[model samples]
Target: MEKYDYEQLVICQDKESGLKAIIAIHDTTLGPALGGTRMWTYASEGAAIEDALRLAKGMTYKNAAAGLNLGGGKTVIIGDPKKDKNEAMFRAFGRYIQGLNGRYITAEDVGTTVEDMDIIHEETNYVAGISPAFGSSGNPSPVTAYGVYKGIKASAKEVFGTDILAGKKVAIQGVGSVAYTLCEYLHDEGAQLIVTDINEEAVQRAVDAFGARAVGLDEIYSVDCDIYAPCALGATLNDQTIPKLNAKIVAGAANNQLELDKHGDLLHQKGILYAPDFVINAGGVINIADELNGYNRERAMKHVDKIYDNLETVFAISKRDNIPTYIAAERMAEERIASLRNSRSTFLQNEHHVISRR
Candidate 1:
């Protein structure tokens, strides 16, 4: 197994339930690692391991940039979410999380739901995004969308010298839970929308609701628009797609959007202002983190809204340092973690490692 300097990579199995999962803890410098758990039917173990490691590292950056006193980790279950989910499967998974004793907290992610989180919560207190009945935040997609919207505006300010999205042509590459809400915001702001998705129903919904023009999936990258929002998946800004993008600003709710460090350089050289995915898409985690503080929606959203200012800070650092925005964001996060690690060296007294007990 290849480890990328991650603090821990735990493989879990529940043979009776045919459950095979991997939980990757990237760092716990500032606090216990916190991130979501995803279930996917990967082609190979290597692919699943890669996803877990990458997502865990992304969460570390996401939490750090969000200014949360938390570290980064992620969990992945290798299976078809639609067919393989069951109470036993998740309970078994949760047992493994409990074994960590709060070193890694898990929540909902792609292929998982609040119900799944509720199941996990049954076995461990180190779970977020549970049902509101459990006094935890539910469904982080809308807040994630709001943060992405704010980031889009920030990118507009950087590239066009104005944050107004009105009269702007924006191409959104996915009409998922997050992007759909994002479209509503853009439409209300008077922006013309061009959208694409694999699901015909989702595409039709956006077209009917927001008057967004629907495009083929492949055509989304080539759409002539002011901003390109990739809400589907990560690494969409790789070598092949970067040359096809016509948007001046690239911002969306995907994690690890850059396929590689050099791809960010490619976007920079193309004069496309790219919002760091971890910074712009920190809303979901930010919203979930509020559960640790007593689940206040207003307070959580207030923090998510700060993504606009944080992204602006990243842009400033990018220009000042003459580096890619992604690098600038990483530098900003690393600096914060480094400084805080130096200043705060004491361990929490709690055995469960509660992040924000109120």
Candidate 2:
């Protein structure tokens, strides 16, 4: 697969800490590449590289759609987060990030935390989402969930002629941190929830807290609901899951929801209104982007609430162009990045050479 098309890819290894990592930068036409560092244990190095490339590209679209003057980059550590994380390892990873200068900035992602970012920050100033005491946003999941909720409402408005989520049935594929917060919002709005997670404890917690009905992991796709929210991982909306979904709308915080580009058109042909994953799940980046200036929870949330309006714009573009929502969102992001690229065609090199053109 021609995954080598990335702008830059760095393979990092630290023998002392037994650390192995990959950082992929997809584009920087808008500005510096910004994304989160994710730690995962993959079956092979190739799998990890593929994931880093895909996620980095997703970040590019996410930043563009969120109207942030940033490009896309991502880091993946080839080890288990629960067992392999330590101060030395992340610090080593940080030194590698520091070597990149400011061309790529990282926060936290799956298997990474704010505390981990703090460790990385000890070695580099090119990190965001450190800690509130460090004048940065701590955790971005709540805002991410908030954006997904707003996107779901936007899709509801397109499908049901109203944005109200009251009495709507939402089948959640995962009840993790972000989805847990999302359940609170949907429950408060009077929406019924059906949750499923590989972690039975997480599913039980959602049932206890939100009165959500727990379902088997395999059954989440076929559940009779108004919306299907895949908050866990990528590629859940694939050939196997799409035909089984009974929901009228698909909106969630998961990145790369579609296994392939063709799956987006499949959803469209099925008459399902889909709120593109990157555009809908951009609240986290929007929140973290605010930390670039200085953390302001109030201002950041106020900006995140704009996801509702952005989804409306995506829907409008989809209707106008007679295309799937995913394609429409990508087109919008590409258009913005293109305009910014032209307006920013000057070379502004820092003395440290932290930001440079390869």
Candidate 3:
């Protein structure tokens, strides 16, 4: 076993139902872990484990950078969401969450919907991103898209010396959920759009709504544009696709965009400014974090809009220091987390180990 490189990971299997699941809680840099639950028909348990662990880690940084009190975590149910789901499966999963106490919290993500979240909520209080009717702020995809929009502006400022996105060619690789909302922002900014998605209806919607040109889902690589926005699934920027990109800046809301970790260096070498995905896509989590009662929409949007400030700073840092934007952003996030942790140790030395996760 590779023993997940993650800070904490627990794989579960319900004895009676033979249901398999993996819960990965990356880091509680800011507070107790929180993120979404994903159900997929992964080919292997190991693959499911890897995805959960990696996504959970992304959540940690995502929440920390967004200035949210919650930490990052993720759950993966390995089976078909349509056919393999049932009350027992979710309850069995809920029991797993109960075992973790409050170390990790789970909500809706990908294959998991609000109705599914309702099921898990019955077992524990460690949940977020629930429907507003259930006393939550509701789905976070729109806010996620909003954050990406702000990030796009920041990327433009770094690459073009202006936040105005008007007339800039933007290639969006997906049209689902966040992508549609993101396109609205891009269209309002007067950006030229070249969009694609595996779903035909979504592609048509983009073309009809924004006068955006539709490209084949797999052909996003060949599109000539000023920016490449991947709002779809992960691992899209691999060795094969990176070589085909015509865009100068790659900014998107999808998690784990780089197919391989080394792809960051590849983008840098290619002179393509890569906005860190976790940083750019922190909007959803930021919005969901508001369910803590006394939550304010205005305050959440303010934080979502703050992506521009953080990214603008990262752009400044990268340009001044001549470093890759991704590297610069990650370094900045790590420094902020370390500084917070250090302050706690200095003031509350005895509580150091309690707050710090080695």
lDDT of 3 by residue, 211-283 (tens): 9999887788878899999988999999889999999899998888998778988998899999989889988
> Which residue pairs clash in candidate 1?
none
**Best candidate, lDDT-wise?**
1
**Model 1 misplaced stretches (Cα beyond 4 Å):** 1-3, 344-358
TM-score of 1: 0.95
The Cα local distance difference test for each model comes to 0.92, 0.91, 0.85
Compared with the true structure, what per-residue lDDT tens digits does model 2 show for residues 144-257?
999898888888998999989999999999888999999999999999999999999999999999999999989999989999999998899899999999999999988899
Worst 10 residues of 1 by lDDT: 344-353
Which residue window of length 10 is worst by lDDT in model 2? 346-355
Error of 2 at 83 (Å): 0.8
TM-score of 3: 0.92
